[model samples]
Target: MSLFASFEKLLSSILLPIAEKIDKQVHLSAVKKGMVVLTPILLLGSMAYPLKALKNVFSDSAAVQEWFINNTYLIDLLIKFSLGFIAIYTVIAIAYFLSEGYKIYTVGAIALSLFSYLILTTSVNPDGSLDIRFFDSKGLFTAIFVAIASVEIYRFFTERKLVIRMPEGVPDFVSSSFELITPTAFIAVLFISIRYFVADFTGGLLVPEILMEVLAPVVGSLDNLWVVWFVIMLRLLFWFFGIHSAVLSPILSPIFVQYLSENIAAKTLAEELPHFVTGGTFSAFVNFTGSGVTLGLVIAMMIAKTQRYRKVGQVSLVPSLFGINEPVLFGAPIILNPILFIPFVLGGSLIGIFPLVLMKYGFLAKPFFDPPYLPLFFEGYLTAFDWKTPFVQLVQIMASFCVYYPFFRIMDKQEMIREAEVQAEKEKKSVFSKKDDELLDELGLDF
Candidate 1:
């Protein structure tokens, strides 16, 4: 009957099924788990970019610069091993996750899947060396395809009992090794054949290159401010309905990571940062203190007169500063709270869109690598490698507060009203209990 009730009913009836589908879908679920597994390594790799910026800043001081220059190699090495071959890691992780679900020997399956991906993407040099250009983020599309395809094929063969079964005395490890041979060979051969066909049909372009060429239009649209904003709005909308918006990460992350890797590569090679939209940019600017940029909302609650608002704000403050806002998300219990809808959705959408305007006008540097879970403005500063970034973030915070203020006022008032009703109910019960005791005493039933 109420507007909030109607909106909630609509979301539950419509969006719930879609959210469930995303969570249960085989490829998507695997991709999500795979990304979660790689998060630590990616965060470590991101540290390299900020340090690289430091190394650049110290160029005027020989001794200081020399110290940084010498130490920079460690960071670069981490980047190369981790983020530099992110696609490879992603494929292996996805394959491992998918294979585990099928009760397959995960390690061997992942290994074969990785090999299959390499076969499709890697090129050979004239001197018999390997060119690993596609091992990095550039190969993301192909990596995903290979990982899923190879894992599915491996699972299919294993499930149908098509592999060699060793006798009872063989070690389990050795038995699995023998069992995987057929499926591995089949998957490898199939991709190798595709590689040959692609080479013949497409003028020698690698699978990654072919994918990049074909998806150029889509990537271009993804880079557009409007399109990026739409996607952000969708994530916020999902969050509003109590769905973990992170389910979409697998689909969006590769595209954003590829762009981010390109910008980092450009920075490393003394070239321009070509991408204006990237994962770091979105993380650092759009969702600065997590979805809804809840830092502003937290501040509003802290200053509100309502007791619950103050308590939730206090509890949420520290975590939100580090870009973790689950405290606020669940504590404020923003999901299905219609009074806070404007702030939850509109505030985030504005925060996400405003940075694009600044970047479009050349007021802010494009983002490079920004590590997750850092304190707020510091992350933004490291991301853009500019002193002005923190200042821009301050402005965004103020703007977000403005957007949240009115909605927060209404929500706070609503909370206070509910608290009043609860207090009145308690007081009424206490008075009734006292009257009953008095009545019992008067009636000589004092027990």
Candidate 2:
């Protein structure tokens, strides 16, 4: 068997099944769904950073500078209420979705998870005030852990019928509230005990701090270029086999989100952004013009010798400009096409990592913004708030064109040959028979 056959067998026998299981896992599904729920919130809140940066843009006008300076509080308020409380929102959302999966009371699970998370992460000030320093990205791991743990605890009790039973005559709301009493008490005590135990054990460290320290090595490795490349390749390989590639999202998105939040925080403080590989990096670079970087293929198609290829390209060009490439992917039929595999996977991966390489060398800026989908080059500019980003994107498009051109030419040639053969067959069938022509010639000899 050929190397491609071996790979196909390995994927179908091993990777595909594993991917399907991970895609359906309840905790992971909840995390993915929760992130989707928070996407709009993050997008709206992140606007504060870029909007505040507008002050630097209009520095020539003293009045505008003063206005921005005075209105800095508004931006801060937006950040404070949105990104600042991201962990809280994350826990609630994850808990609600996870509970729904367990077929339990979602609101009750959310309350327990939130309450438990607060107990573990929130601290008391010397002056009797509450401290919520961990309510941001700093508390993300703790929030995830607490949400899952608290919900599992709720599920355990509720599934086993361990809750207080209110009489049937009572209202459903009151009865549901009563049912949660036992689990809430158990979760509250468990987390409160853990909070104190960890504080004493670590000589005043909180759960979030401990988790961050423990997971530091693992989290830090995400910045490695090789690791990022491997992940990019996996996504492309999945897409090559006609998988949606979203199966990996549940595992990767939380880390991407955390890195993005940290970068946004650093930018907000006017500090150097800490992370280079972020969710925005994937959007602006790796998945440029859709997964597998098929925009280049569409470009090649547009200029092909064959009419079919040109038509598909023309129809797909508009959507590709906006990062939608399904029309080209299916039309060009890149999926499982051995002729296009090399450029689709290897070339696409290289093109995807090109901008990241520039960022690694300080030629391009790290992404801190993740704006909603806009046209290609424009979105790249918004991603890093850097003038150089659009230029880098242009280079990527050109690189994609170069990488895909040769492979596309090969496919175009084969398609042209196939089209000619098909046309010849049709012409052969449409020709009149010899006997019919003889009769026609006899009847219309003068004409």
Candidate 3:
């Protein structure tokens, strides 16, 4: 009859089951875990530029400037090897994980996937070396698709016992080397055929470019506020169901990074902000404190009457402040909690909308610099290279708090009631056990 009860029924009947299904789906599970495995390195890569950005703050100081100038090589090194090769890592990770799920040999699968990915992305420089552009974010979608497809092919051949098998006397290392030959050759040929022989759908565009074109309408529409909201909303929705949002990152990150790149280019040319929505916009602004903007929710919980809320809030608060929310999401158990469904998602979606409105009215500037590792509001300010953006972030935090507050209170009350019931049941059990103990003592005397 109550709102919480209705929520419980709905979640049990629909949301929880669907979430379980998603978590169990092989490909989706692979994508989620694979991307998660890559998050740390990607996060480190994202942080690489912040050192340079911090150095810029002291540009007027000769000693500080000299130190940064001397260390520019290090900054470049971090960004280049890490973020620069992100697509390569993504493909290898996806292939490795998918192969793991299919019970295929991981190392060979990764090698095959990497080889096939390179085949599809083969581009030559004027100096005859391989062009590295597609090895980065530009080739992300290609990398993901190729990784998945290549692994499937590997699984197909290996599962059917199509590969040459070594006799019992051979070493595993030597045996695997021979076993890898057939599947690797097949994977190589498959991609090679698609690369060279497949008919061009969009006037000689390669697979990645063609895929980009197919996704163009959606990517192009990101400039619209509604589309941005929808994308962010969908991400939050998945997170609520315990799905790792990074599964969609390869698809969305390229678009976000492209828009951010355009913003950087425009700034270099002294032009206007090319687009309002960007990767930096989401990373530095919308997801200021991780998915669901749960820093605000963490704060709300910190003030709650429920003991569980307060404890989890304390544990999650500091991390959420820095844009990580897993401690609370899993600890407070946000997933499948009906009381949190509205706030966890809708609150996060709200964070994305505020920036668009601010940009429309000239209250905030579009982000230009791509600084990372900086904390929430600071990250926003650095990205925009404008002080006002931090102020906007503060306002957004307050707005998020307002959005999460009501639902949080309801959840807090539910927790308190549950705790009370649990305590009463424990006391009742203890009383009955004590009475039984007394009766047992009297019977022991007769015995």
Candidate 4:
């Protein structure tokens, strides 16, 4: 029992610091900006005649397909469906620039994308006016194919460090098979096959379905304790995707709205006492929580013990409350600290729970206010119910900070150890350099 207790403490200590650093360093803002701008291009490119058949591609839903068999619209839709791949490629190329930097594979990317676009466009109508019945597997294939291309493009530039490692004895071909190139090729081949068979090329087959499915279970089980796990998973995912609140907001808002809302789908929301006044089924609850822009990173700053990190924690506190953690993440350099693991996670957990607690207590009527990243102090109070939500929000923020405080101190100590190591290395180097300097004095090499 004692051993376990000690182990638990040690683990928490290590994790607390690690978590804190991660909270600070995560970056998704740039990705969100790129995605937002890319949406229109993706929509337009997915059509046979981007300008004319664009509307047709969108309208070719199951209802349209059932109603308009053998129609001209279908043909156009297929053309556009494949063409959507070009749009995805273009968007990805642009978004890559927005999110990260440059890629070495531009020559191949440009060549393949242009060819795919030409095939997709010319298939339905050379003049760019096609129909909606074109919604076939090719469309799906094109979209995925393009998306894969763009994602790979975006990831290459945006990747901080290569996290993937080649296994010790794995064959090169087998190892490289799972890499982005092979799977993307497979998707393209599969999509082309589907397009040829179905005639309607714009397919919505796999990736979207996968994305939806992944979100479904987590969104569906709003009341489960596992929801916390869902939230944590989301945070981790955002980290992987480049930590942008904008990207996370759209994904998370619906779930949070569902959590605080009684009315779902066609059903009315369950009635509850008005907390702040807006009361019942607000999306704000989710938004504010994800705005993890606040002192969540400050907690990491606190856990950081080095003089540099301490200055970071102390300095970033004010801005952090306004929901901006980037300053601290970059400034403190806490992207991968192990000790701050505790507070970093708990902070988000508490932020999510803060409104939940209020919603439950009838202190707030409903979580109606959408979470925002700026103006940190007023962040929580923006929720629909009780004024205490703000106070509670404040408390939650403090709790995040507090959780990281001791652990940060421990990490600060660790930073000192690191600095010491650096200094020691420098000193050893200096000794060798000193001898060289002395020899230079005799040799007259000194300037």
Candidate 5:
């Protein structure tokens, strides 16, 4: 066997099963679902700073400036409730999904998880108000941990039938509420004790702070260009084998979200955004026109000699423009097609990272806004609010065309040959065969 065949077999034998397990894992599934639930909220929150920044467009108008100044608080409210308390929202969503998975009382599990997160991350100030400094992106890791842990605790007690069971004839809500009393008390005491223990042991650091500090290196490394490139490459490799890229979301989504929140915070403060990589970066650049950057392949197909390829291309065109490419991936059948593997993986990676490299060099601005699934060039412009962004996207598309052109020609030729042979076979099997024509001629029937 060839080297590529050996490598392909190795990946199928090893990675496919592992990917399947990750896809089905309950907690990860909950996290992916939770992020999906939060997407709309995140999009609304991300718009806050950009909308406020719009005042700059009318710098010549004092009235517009005054109006913006008067309504700054209204914009701030969007940020305050959405991104400001993002961790709280994340925990609640994750807990609800996870409890549903465990076949337990979802309401009780959600309440316990929220309580645990607040208890671990918040404090009462001397002014008798709550201090919620970690309620935003800073507490995401803690939120995830508390959500999983608290739900598991609720699941444990409920599974063991350790709850108070109200007698028959009681209302279902009443009975369910009573069922959670024991586990609630246990989780409350357990978390409170740990909170006190951590405070004493760490000289006043809270759980979220401690976690951020402990994981600082890992989080910080995500900003490196090489690291981001490696991740994009890995995702493309998984796509090459026909695996959905979302399998990596359980691990990467939270970090990307945290970075995005930080960027928006920086934008709101009118400061330089700290992170170079974000979820917006991936959506606008790396996965532009869908994973493996297959929009160019669609373009290639649209102009191909094969009628089937041209039809698939025309069908996939609109969806690809909106960043949907499953039609292209499966229709063009790039997945597991060795003829297209190099362009899909290596060429896609190179195209994906080109704009990021420009951002690193200060030619392009880093993404602070994360508008969802707007059409291609428009999405790029909205992401960074820069006029140059669309041009950069055009360059990436051109690069994609160049990379996929030669490989696409090879595939098109093979398709053409296959179509011709099939047509020839159909002609040979025609209803009026050559022998039938001869018999008709021998009968000398006049038309």
Candidate 6:
């Protein structure tokens, strides 16, 4: 009957059960966050063979192997999806360890996530056995690290009643979890390390078979850009219609990259060699949502700056159109308002079209598709040698900024207008009240 009770029921029905299961474990270590990212990064390992798999599954390509290499760039996008697993797991793990402590269920959840990847890795590879080899080294390190985390997580769970007996040398906020480290703090450390590893690998293209990734965008015509373009457009459309961006990303990005490799293969080795390592998307702006369209959250940040000149002209430009409007939406308070939705859709549309046009022309070379993931910016340069990819990126950014700037300015001015009206109304009300009081005395009025 009460609002709180309704809310409790809703939460328990939806989020609470999931929270309860993971709550069985408590982890407060940097390693725990690594677990958060571990799933996504590991899952990306599967993207290494998208087109090839599609080629085989559909028997689509005349040369499946060639198509496979051509679309190699999608691997990165596939790998990036694994990061989502890590993020979800890490948050749940951290939340549980902080609130409920650690238990067998906690370990099971963590193990479930890891094994999910392991099973995925094994089943995906036909010839390769359980990769018990990497399991020894990487797996061992991960296990020991997991043990430390589980120990802390377990203690935190059963010992929740003793949080007041918090560690003597520790800070207060951290003591809330009954765990050794906060999820955020530990995850940050894990982030730095994983980021380092992704960038640090010396191998030219050495994601193990267990972690091999593929980009299998289903295309209609094998030799045509129109088909590829159609696929790309379909991918963009899916952002509005559905959640297949993750499934489609590995396919669309590799189209142009495949072209780039062929177009420039005879020209120079620098242009033909795959530039990105691990074959995933590097554009922070784009994700499973597609590049530049990160979300309304990005748009929110841009609008939040509090200055029209700062907020409108330059702030929302680069991010809004590229599909990353989280800055503009959250920053600007355009959220939940009908007025701002006009610019959001319009800006996104205009910015989205320009690059595809340029790619159609000779102005920009298509990306080489090694480690395939959709790229929004110059990061598309990660593909095999398309020297002009940077130019195309610059244009996309400039175009996105241009379209978003005017729209943002309009919105900012409107925002200012509303604020002025509110202030004016307040001032007028105050003056009228004081005048009425004086006039009332003149009339000798007393209610």
Residue pairs clashing, model 3:
none
TM-score of 2: 0.95
Write model 1 residue lDDT over 374-414, tens digit each, in one string.
Answer: 78788778777788888888888888788887888988888
Most TM-score-accurate candidate: 5
Number of clashes in every candidate structure? 0, 0, 0, 75, 0, 87
* Per-residue alpha-carbon lDDT of candidate 5 for residues 1-447, written as tens digits (9 for 90 to 100): 998899899988987998999989999999999988888888999999788878998999999999998989999999989999999999999999999998888988999999999899999999999999899999999999999999999888888998999999999999999998999999999999999999999999899999999989888888888988888888988988999989999888899889889999988888988887788888888999998778899999999999999999999999999889999889889888898889998899989988989887789998888888889798888888889998889988888888998999998999999999999998887855766877888999534
The positional error of residue 41 in candidate 3, measured at the CA in angstroms, is 4.4
RMSD score of candidate 5 (Å): 2.0
Local distance difference test values of all predictions, in order: 0.83, 0.86, 0.76, 0.45, 0.90, 0.41
Model 4: CA > 4 A from native: 1-220, 223-229, 237-305, 330-336, 371-373, 427-447
> Which residue pairs clash within candidate 5?
none
How many clashes show up in model 4? 75
In terms of lDDT, model 5 sits at 0.90
User: Which segments of model 2 are wrong by more than 4 Å?
Assistant: 432-447
Off by over 4 Å in 3: 1-14, 40-55, 61-78, 125-127, 199-203, 220-223, 231-348, 356-362, 365-386, 400-447
For each candidate, C-alpha RMSD in Å? 2.7, 2.5, 5.9, 16.4, 2.0, 16.0
- Candidate 6 Cα deviation (angstroms), residue 97: 18
1-447: candidate 3 lDDT, tens digit per residue = 988777657655775566567667787677666665665665555555456677768878999888887888887777667666777887888888898888878898899889998888867879998877776666777787888888888888878989999999999888888988998888777787887764454465677777777877877888877888888888787777777766566456556655654565455446988678766667777787878777778888899998888999999988887888899889877887777888777777877578766775677887655555577677778666677887788887888788888888888888899999999999999999888888989888433
Ten-residue region with minimum lDDT total, candidate 3: 260-269
Candidate with more favorable, higher TM-score: 1 or 2: 2
Candidate 6, residues 172-281: lDDT per residue as tens digits? 54454443334324434553454346446733322232122322233214344455334444443333322233443223322322332233332223443222212233
Superposed Cα deviation of residue 406, candidate 5 (Å): 0.6
In model 2, which range of ten residues has the least summed lDDT? 428-437
